[model samples]
Target chain A: MFNIFKLAARNLRRYKRRTLLTSILITLGVVAVLLFVSVSGSFKAMMIGQITDSMLGHLQVHSRGYLSSIDSLPLHLNMKGEQVVRVKEILDGNDAVEAYSMRIRLGAMFSNFTETTNVRLNAVDPEQEMQTVPMLADRIIKGKKEGLLAKGEILVPELIARGMKVKIGDTIVLVATNKHGSVNGQPFVVRGILEGISGPGGRDGFIHTDDALALLRIEGREISEIAIRLNEMEQMHEVFDELKGQLESSRNKMDKPVFEVHTWEELSPFFNIARMIDLMTLFIKIMLVAIVLVSIMNVMVMAVYERINEIGTIAAIGTGPGKILSLFVAEGFLLGLFGTLIGVVISLITIAGMNAAQISFDFGRQKGLLLSPTIASGEVIVIAGIVIAIAVLGSLQPAWKAAGMDPITALRHV
Target chain B: MTLVTAKGLEKTYIAGDITVRAIRGVDFTIEPASFVCFIGPSGSGKSTLLNMIGCLDPPTSGFLEVAGKDVTHLGAKESARFRGDHIGFIFQDFNLIPVLTVFENIEYPLQMVQNWPALKRKQRVNELLEAVAMKDQGGKFPNQISGGQKQRVAVARALVTNASLVLADEPTANLDTETANRIISLMKQMRDEFGTTFIFSTHDHRVVKSAEKIFTLEDGKLQQQGNGDNHV
Candidate 1:
């Protein structure tokens, strides 16, 4: 085995230029794949983070009818009812539950003296809001941040503030509408501008609990939605399941109001698009590996052809065609192994460079900055497996050619 | 016992509407440790006969027994192993693997066939290189050597596995008169030292003169046998 490998190594060294050229092609393919996979990973992370941190949280608990009809305006999901509190208690008991908050959301028009625009208004308890929506901190700009928490003070996104011609310290008159066809008006002081936040929540207006209660004229209504946060991003499903089971059990025993539990995945179905991008990246990697396989096949074929006479001579000396075939196959495997090592090193360097460069992204409304390699170690191992499989498969034809050589003809070849 | 025996050996090749017979109805035997040569004009089937005796080519029809094993239609892998254990070959063009140095080329068969220890292979390569008077040139690649030196390396490579018989197919064809004579003499000396039998297909009198027994062929059939004359 060792002798055959040595011979293969020596033969490869004989044509230094060809070997170098093939290695370069392999390296290029690896680089392209690494960049695609890494960037796609970063994009996926950014997208999911944006959705969960800004809007959906990890899970949402709302009244079943309320979710079915957006016209259920100023509607309270009754999450503060006994049954809802039982579910929340169960979730809060779970070690996975990092944070939980109840909020009332409504669509309304906000007007300052000169202008008006329709916007979503969220009424949140400021203390619990920090745990469920940390991204709100990211939105505070051009004003004191305390306005997000202060009683009867409202925070407006840049878009809403611009449309309303309002700024901090300005009073905006908000008219809240409900399914009962009643509209009530309340005036609130604009506290801050959510400077860079984009998307539905960012473009809408938000207020403290007391202010929203005053605007909606609902003094003692049930809480609208229960938003949850998990210790890790992946624990959302398990926690949601536990909370759902608790809610179901409580509902069976009592004639209380019912709520639907929604995980972040369902509330934000577009998360599937991020996964699709990952699949697409994987497909591209497969194609690239195939190309590398073909390139390796060509290199092995040329190596076999060049060593035709040597193979014949070895066969004549009774080395066995099996041994000859194994030698060439081993050569191909070694080439792939070496190329994969090179690829891994190059990928690490490129990832490090990208992270060092602190690349930022702005895709229309979505914004993000990537500062590290998003490729997991498991994914790297999968890539290695792919490279090896390609190498071994690529070696088959060349090894067969070497093994099938006719000793007499090979010896006679000039 | 006869070292090689063939009965009614035959070979046929098809080349697009033509059947070419390279060897036909040949029966022969060779004794152990004999310096033998098959001599004939081109296309007379001397090389084909050598290939059959060396077990490099399977006989189309008939029995071929080498070292008491019948291997008339051995598979490629089997034949290669058989040859590695029992036969070696020297070619006209000096088929030395170009990438390997003289010592490495000589050590190749030992490593591939014998599974010899590294120390053993090293010792055998050194011994063969010294025998060929290429002790100082063992580190040089085949291409870097003179024609005679290349032939010497080829001889050393053939003998590296300690096979009982060596087949030389017009081994001197690529060399000038002086180099050819030197290579022939070295092959003879190697045969004497190792007691390895040598079989050659040659038109060179110098090679024939070195053979103890000579056979002539014509049109895929053996023509005659004689004690070669001491010419050249």
Candidate 2:
């Protein structure tokens, strides 16, 4: 068997140009698909990272009814007191949850005591929210990112600051209605100017949890939701599943589901765009298969055609039909093997070169999105296997024809 | 012993609506370890007779035997096995496998057909290379050798498996007269050494001159059989 494969290998050396061209065709296909899968996969992953790591915090825990009317900022539907502690127990008990932060999101009117505009406001625990979304501080263009807003202080978005003529250290008043439907107002100092975000609901204001509770006249321990960050994005669903099972399993003192769980993919609308990129990668792979199938099959047929006399000679020398078939099939398999091997080596170099080159693109509010092509070992193995399998499939017809040839006729084929 | 026996052998071809008779009923017998030649003009069924005798093609309507085994009805696989075991073929064009070196081509038949052990195969190939005076050219490819040298390699390849009957179809048609005579002399020596019977389908009189016995065919019919240029 080894001798046959070696013999088959030498056959390629007989037609250097044909073998090289065919190998190049298959190599191009493998390289193209591998690189496309890796680079597009990286782009998709990076975009999801922007939403999950920087904005959405991977998973969110909130009341089932809150997300439905979250646009209305219904303060009455927030998690509070013992229920918050219960959710914390569920979260803290699980190792997948790296961190969780509580936020009280509300709609409020922002004014310089003269010019007034509606703004979405999030009242957050300074330390926890800052840790959960570290990029938020990174986007603070005009103030220190080390600490969150202090009591009687707020972080104003540049959009609103420029519109209302507010700057760092300026005093501003926020007026809002509480869960009781009563109106209230409070004075606060602008501690920082945040760079404006790009997606929906990106322009917002951040204030201390105590300031929000005081302004809303809430003496109780009610909050909007718990935002969770996990250690790894690849394991996002596994963590989400574990979190879901524990929270949904909470049969209250009476058998009622208290909290709903969601991964960033569910909560962020930008996730749909990421899914489309993955689907595009799938299409590119199919295209590679077509290119390899056509080229490899084409080359095998020509091989059989050119070697008709050799086939006849071997047959007359008592080589069985099965051996003849195997001979041609081995040729195709070798073609795929060499092509895939070269393609993978070249693709690895290409990917490393790409990373070293540090190609960049701007997507939404994020700049310099790195184009890193990442391939798992399993993916390379599978790609090489598929290309070789296709090579064999493409050779089947021609090999069969070669094996079925009548020696007398083939001997005369010139 | 009778190494080949054929009685009423026939072959026909269908071309569109017409049936062409390539060979009419023919009868002949050859003895073991003899150098025999079948000589005739073109279309005289010389190759057709050799093809039938070598198990390359089945007889259309007759009983034929080679090495005392009936080959008139052998199937494709069985015929190939039988040919590998008992028959060797030398084509006019010296049909050597171009990819293989001279030694590899000679060793190929043993590997593919007889399943000879490597040491035995190597021994036989080396002996034939010595016998053919191609010992030093074993590493060269067929294209690297001269026409006569290529024919010598083909002869070595054919006999490497130790077939009982070696069939040479117009083996000397491509060489010059002197080269053809030399190749015929080489075959006579191989027969003396290996004691393998040889049958030739040839148009050249030089090959006939070297044969101990010659059969002449005309229009697919046996016209003469003689020993040492004497026919009844």
Predicted model with the maximum TM-score: 2
Clashing pairs in 1: A317-B84, A318-B80, A318-B84
Q: What is the lDDT of residue A31 in candidate 2?
A: 95
Give candidate 1 regions above 4 Å deviation. A1-5, A65-80, A113-116, A146-148, A178-185, A196-200, A210-221, A235-265, A269-276, A334-347, A359-361, A365-377, B230-232
DockQ of candidate 1 is 0.70
The model with the greatest lDDT is 2
lDDT of 1 by residue, B1-232 (tens): 8888889989998899999999989888888888998888899898888888888777899888887789897876677778888888898888877877888889878887778899988998999889999999988988789988988888988888888889898899899999998998888888889988899999988888878888888999987887777432
Q: What is the lDDT of residue A285 in candidate 1?
A: 87
| TM-score value, chain A, candidate 2 | 0.91
- Which ranges in model 2 have alpha carbons more than 4 Å from their true place? A80-86, A149-151, A196-201, A242-258, B5-12, B21-28, B60-62, B112-120, B218-224
Candidate 1: residue B125 lDDT (0-100)? 90
Candidate 2 chain B has its poorest 10 consecutive residues by lDDT at B223-232
